[model samples]
Target: MDTFRKFALNIAVFISFFSGLNAQQTYFEGVYSEKKIIINNPLSADLFGTCIHRITINGEIYPFNISDNYLEVDLSLLSIRKGELFSMTIDHESGCVPIIYNKNDFKFKEGVKFISLKADGNKLSWQSQSEVLLSSLLLELKFRDKWVKIAEISSNGMGNQNYEYIVPFLLSGKNQFRISKSNTKQYYYFPVIDMTEQHYKIASNSVTKHINIIKNNKPAVTCYELKDLHGVIVKKGIDGTIDVSNLKNGFYKLYFDTKEEVIIKK
Candidate 1:
């Protein structure tokens, strides 16, 4: 007919403009200062560092350390990262907490060190070039309430396009904290009730440690064991004491030994 209906309407408008540019939805804008945090990823050379950035207050997790001028992030925690978009300022000399990122679609994959996230059933498996294939990749899933955001994936085979976001936390019985990239600035204190008596007394923010208590799901107690002067293992059931005082401050997770402590209840 008329040239095959204009070649099927020009291949359906070029496959709907290449599926709307692969579903697009990756834009981040920033500008925060106290020392630095100015991000304007007009796709900044297509995601400068390659992506592995992080920021989460109420739930912990705060990892971002790109350098060159600045990009520290974590001003004292306030809950950030809703697809990125900020503008802050306050650098007085060495207050340090800058943050800036417009990093286009994000990408960063060099030698590929580690990227892992697990949870299989509803789906969530993203492993990097190697971590033993991270159990085999299942990809995509984000719910975040009790927590659930597994392997957001992105690697392109290492050239300079690495993006790995793995999140999973639904251990209701509690105990799964994570936050320690460390420059200095820590606060984690939880004790309302549940130590069954072993002696009590806590408050030494020298970056205290050791405080994991999960009840039912497992792991009952352990309290006190701080470390992070570069000693690495930041905190792990510092001494062993949980009475919760009464319970009602909010946020908790202290698994001790194996590692995993993030507490707060004031």
Candidate 2:
């Protein structure tokens, strides 16, 4: 049996505290394969049976009946494409809410472990713990709204898992990286921190004060957000020094792009 396990479902619950009532919030977990997929409920049956659960993919509804706390889907008859995204929902008299059920989020194949990728300056580094040797992989950078292919790297089968590639062109502000084999659905995102700097300084903590901002010559438009210790954003402005004279006396986090700095108000 081709078993895929441990993936979580996006469960949305609508609860009314005053009435001591809650709408159905289905928690789906477990295995999905070519022959069949099992969506098991991690919550009580009361929340589930209270609403109607349906799996809709590509505009087709595949109805299922809950048996033994799971919705078993037999794909032998359904013409569902492998690696296609789908959505789930619960319909009730109170409201109809949609849930996230993407096919790509599941691991259908075995022996494919995840690797870690990092970006420092203009260089990209990737490391894997798996002994499986990867031959060739494609690298793409997110530029504006489009994906730009930066490199197609070929690896020699010498059992070396750590690799690094330097970017030839200049990358402005912040960007994302995608590394995978060409034409395959198996791709991974490398989380990289933004290297852009926001030249800002808090002048004073008095009732009336101004922040000083030094502008840099970068093409990308930068935005700044001032967040409290609880991570609540108090104020936001375009990539420059913002006035926080009206804010409470406490420590605040200054966020611009992927960078963060802590500031205090007396």
RMSD of 2: 17.4
> In candidate 2, how many Å is residue 160 off?
5.3
Provide the overall lDDT of each model, using Cα atoms, as 2-decimal numbers: 0.32, 0.50
Model 1: residues >4 Å from true position, as ranges? 1-119, 126-169, 173-210, 220-266
Show the lowest summed lDDT stretch of 10 residues, model 2.
4-13
Candidate 2 ranges with C-alpha deviation above 4 Å: 1-114, 129-135, 158-160, 197-266
Please estimate how well model 2 matches the true structure, expressed as its whole-model Cα lDDT: 0.50
Clashes of 1: 49
Models, CA RMSD each: 22.7, 17.4
lDDT tens digits, residues 78-197, model 2?
A: 454443322334332234333334444444332233476787777888864432333567788765345667678875322226878886533345667788765466778877647554
Candidate 1 versus the native: TM-score? Answer: 0.16
